[model samples]
Target: MPARFMQMQEVADELSVSVSQVYHMVRSGELPAIKVGGRGQWRIERARLEDYIERKYTETADWVRENPLIGREDEIDPSD
Candidate 1:
């Protein structure tokens, strides 16, 4: 079956975030979406979104492989 897609507004509303947040999600590639036609409407596939969420969760599973608190030893801590 063909994948069903949702607009940026729909995604934002479903996620309970702002439209800008949805845009940022697309920009960051955290949310799998596509721009359709020349108008460039941000449309996300339900399967793609689910896949993205799964991929993210799986990717983060390695963080605690050593120490959960240890994040980017070279980068400055944001809380500091």
Candidate 2:
């Protein structure tokens, strides 16, 4: 069976970000997770992680739609 939950480190590796960044994400309510174990460890549900990624994608698309880049082709030089 697939994993139902993942540790903070696992989430960090999956996202290619620092473990501390994952911790801050959890703390900021950006990602969904639960604190388990006697030492107050974090466990993120695999589905929730996927949902977070999807949400970020949507947010980025919206931002790009709102703020498009403009360029002038004539402003470039052929030789640097």
The CA-based lDDT of model 2 is what?
0.94
What TM-score, computed on C-alpha atoms, does each candidate reach? 0.60, 0.86
Candidate 2 has what TM-score?
0.86
CA displacement after TM-score superposition, residue 80 of candidate 1 (Å): 22
Per-residue lDDT for 1-80 in model 2, tens only?
Answer: 97999999999999999999999999999998999989999999999999999999999999978876567566668784
- Model 1 is weakest, by summed lDDT over 10 consecutive residues, at 63-72
Q: lDDT tens digits, residues 39-79, model 1?
A: 88789998887787678687778665655556567775778
Superposed model 2: Cα runs more than 4 Å off: 72-80
Q: Output candidate 1 Cα RMSD.
A: 6.2
Clash pairs for candidate 2: none
Which 10 consecutive residues of model 2 have the lowest summed lDDT? 67-76
Off by over 4 Å in 1: 1-3, 55-80
